[model samples]
Target: MTKPHRHASHPKLVARLKRAEGHLRSVVEMIEAERPCLEVATQLQAVESAIRNAKQALIHDHLDHCLDADSSEHDRAELKAITRFL
Candidate 1:
């Protein structure tokens, strides 16, 4: 089996995701509290942005460290596929 590849940025990405999780919880609390729609939407947007940035960072780290001169076409294809999220 292939060994797992770890990136230096993983901790930061996890931290970002955790913050997004907290933001999501706040969004739910806001909804339950009957907050204004605009306020909720703004907070929700921040959560979305955080998650998106984390994902993009992870994908970039993968491309940078996991793929190399010996990487296969399939791997390159997968790289293209993953970027669709960004």
Candidate 2:
């Protein structure tokens, strides 16, 4: 049997991850520069928040565009599994 295709990666998600990469680099710089503990912690938190937001955006796109576009019982079960993992 052929494998199922879930949400394929797209440009917008790639761009978001690139931006997150920059944010992660900044976090490393903050550590190397010996910035104050609080400031470094804040940037770390920002990295977490950025990742979470990006994940949500990708999921939103997948739900709105892919899952919503396909509505068979098999698709519904696949969606349920994906949602559980998400």
Q: Write the per-residue lDDT of candidate 2 for residues 33-66, one digit (tens) a residue.
A: 9999999899889888878877877766667766
Error of 2 at 15 (Å): 1.4
Best by TM-score: 1
Task: Give all candidate RMSDs, comma-separated.
Answer: 2.0, 3.5
* Per-candidate clashes, comma-separated: 0, 0
In model 1, residue pairs whose N, Cα or C atoms come closer than 3 Å (at least 3 residues apart or on different chains), thus clashing, are none
Best by lDDT: 1
Give the Cα-based TM-score of candidate 2 against the true structure.
0.72
What tens digits encode model 1's per-residue C-alpha lDDT throughout 8-85?
Answer: 999898889998999899999999999999999999999988888888899888877888878888877877787787
Instruction: Determine the C-alpha RMSD for candidate 1 after optimal superposition of all C-alphas.
Output: 2.0
Error of 1 at 30 (Å): 0.5
